[model samples]
Target: MIINFSNLMFITLNIMSTLYMISANCWINCFLAMEINLFFFIPMIFSPNLFNMEMIMKYFIIQVTSSIMILLCILYYKNFIFNLILIILMNFCLLMKLGSVPFHYWYIEISNIISWKMFFMLSTWQKLGPMMILLYNFNEYIMIFSIIMNSTIGMLGGLNQISLKKIMSFSSINHLSWIIASSMISEIMMMIYIFTYTMMMFFIMMKFEQMNLINIFQLFFFKKKMMIMISFFIYFMSLGGLPPLMGFIPKWLTINKLMENKFILVSVILIMSSLINLYYYFKIVYYMNLNKNYKINFFIEYNFKFSFYLFNYLIMTNLSYLLIYMFYY
Candidate 1:
């Protein structure tokens, strides 16, 4: 309901820049598109709130620094004595941009102050352009190191967080490892994983926003609402990559692909870290399911909202179609 023309324009331009990066043949074009996308996105996160201004500043500083380094590396690529150093530097910059481990401090801090809508954008769309650029000339050794670090730190970071935003921030980092790994295997596989992740996060964020939830404890207030409970269970479980759910497909495929390519150690590490991710996800769902004796004046009617049915329908249909396609062919 609070739509702004300027915000819409920024969103469009940001998306266009992302597309440009994806199709760009050269590193210069990709870097330019990335900077444009970052600038466009910055305006959308600005607000009158003082705390949010700090968040904006931190995000801007980190992204600009990374951009500067990447640009420097690109400009000096021809003169550099070793191509390996350039690849490592560029890969590190992209990893920093993606908010993977070792560069994730800024990411978690910024997410804490942003709105849920911005959090969705930060976790999803903002990552696409940099990730696409990363595919151009990634270093295998650096990527493997990132895989190990991200899988470990991403899980450990979320273990004790009471804030929902922080938990999801860590979750995004954990998922980023899978995404980076998938990109190594196949671009198409990465796209499918990203698509599924975006959809699951979209629905979960919608539900959280609708209920005005900010932390794990807030879930106690909605325990009486069956529809909310059920929806939370489905979406969170899917996000955890549980089998028979839509989220598991991309993960299963990624593991299979990794094993196929003989990345057995990385595959095993990812699986172990995923189980830990699932642990925290299940902790959240458990919090929602816990019975509470508190009473409130307002009552949620037995009938559910339109969103509940719509989300469930989409999940079931997508899972069925995916199953048939993956197995049939």
Candidate 2:
């Protein structure tokens, strides 16, 4: 109860700091808010001591370096160009915060060290605070850089991961490109994609937890059909954007927008990347279908009955919301 309460408090404080950054006219206050946000997360991540001390040390170094960069950038942000520099620093800070590429080693290590619950929070909720902070400082160039680098590296790097958590972390990164790209087209599309991605990820994470499944190939032993269904939910079609599914919508819109502007190479790259990226997701599918015998690999006892239902409801509701908004709005 105490830990949960403290977690709640930290989350609440971080959120308030983000809104303070958005509403604060004073630059000092804004940077302070960001600093508070950064510090709060470090404490939360380190509080358990479950992670490798080395990982904690590395995380601290990277975070402090990025924080200083943001501080210096804030000092120089007196005009548009300086603001651009600040934006770069701030986005880099988020890139650091979320463990996106060029600074992605932390993610690979952290997932191995931390608990899955912590991983889920770090992967999803921690990203939200940064997204809120970033929205106030949007520029097209920043979005483009974020999309291209995040998409290209995130997808390609994720291809080599065997840990389900690391794969999901990179999966989150891949969707980050789509989300950032969505901002370029329409707010509705962005919201829809994020909502769907979050919901689906919640299901995927919880399902993996319940099954005591850690790595990808472990799915091969689950005789339960429900597990297969869950695997399909994650792989075959997500919330309207992959291909021949509802999840394909945002990707289509994004590609079309880029093409209209004659971004032929970029479009081709994204398409090619997606084709390459689908391999791992399909691998899980193949493994789940290969073996008929169930051999439980997890020692930790888990009951996923409630989580499965909750996620089903969320996926359906969010998908419905996406359809309605796209059709009517």
Candidate 3:
């Protein structure tokens, strides 16, 4: 156990060094970073929780395959083809990491088994380190592939999902695509995308915890129709990229930047994909309002519709202003 823990610690340090190297934008250094990120998850497979063996095995194989690709790309420095192949392979692994289909098998399984907080870390931070390396090394082409992968899978897979965890996983995938989209354009879009995604996700997971609601289907039991409707509308609308919400900020920037860069086809595809996403988002809205099957017993001690009162005004105000700032920005 000590040996395994030490090895994991060492691999994590290697990953950190690689991230720093890539952030400097040196090509060879970036390749090293990719290789390190690919290999660092190996020891995670040896974890004793012993719950997700199959998923861990799959993740291990995928990471090793991706790492081998990166190493080969490094060996043949002159061949851009290897570099491209390496990028695509690593991108494929990241898609799998982020739980986007058609590589989404491990996503649901591991998430189902892991603690929510660990699941949150896996979905958010673990992906970020590798993603930062990708952006630093090969932003444009890699980002295009990421955007297509994320938008296509997220919107289509998330349709009609009732499981809250699964839905949040797909939502994470979509927002990740948004981050990839922003990365292609400029540094500022990337920054804003990261910040907004973090804040949005913080609210989502917390709200999920507060409601003690297991699935999106149970969201109707949240009690206060007045506030539930409002909060749910804000959340879904933000997800839908509706006006003045914080969610629109990234999309607004993405579309403008893409048009400016003359990537019209990809831009159009993404916009239409957002529409596909909205189709499902509205379904939640429909159920939240029109569902007469739910018992509306109000919780006297804690209202899940709004957050704790100390944060109540502050959270609501900022959320509403996402709409305002969407227009303003």
Using lDDT as the measure, the top candidate is 1
Q: Write the per-residue lDDT of candidate 2 for residues 185-291, one digit (tens) a residue.
A: 66666666665566666666666666878887777666556445555655345532455444565577778877887767667766766765676677666677687
Stretches off by above 4 angstroms in model 3 are 1-51, 78-102, 139-145, 221-229, 290-329
**For model 3, how does the per-residue alpha-carbon lDDT over 165-210 read when each residue is reduced to its tens digit?**
7766776777777777777776667767676666656665666666
How many angstroms is residue 317 displaced in model 3 relative to the true structure, after the best TM-score fit? 6.4
124: Cα error in model 2, Å: 2.2
Q: RMSDs, each prediction?
A: 3.2, 5.2, 5.7
The list of candidate 2 runs beyond 4 A from truth reads: 1-3, 18-27, 47-51, 79-91, 138-142, 186-188, 227-236, 243-246, 294-319, 322-324, 327-329
For model 2 the local lDDT of residue 77 reads 75
Which candidate, 2 or 3, would have the higher lDDT against the true structure?
2
| Least accurate 10 contiguous residues by lDDT in model 2 | 235-244
- Per-residue CA lDDT of model 1 for 158-191, tens digit only, reads 9999999999999999999999999998778888
Q: Compared to the true structure, candidate 2 yields what TM-score?
A: 0.78
What TM-score do all the candidates reach, one by one? 0.92, 0.78, 0.72
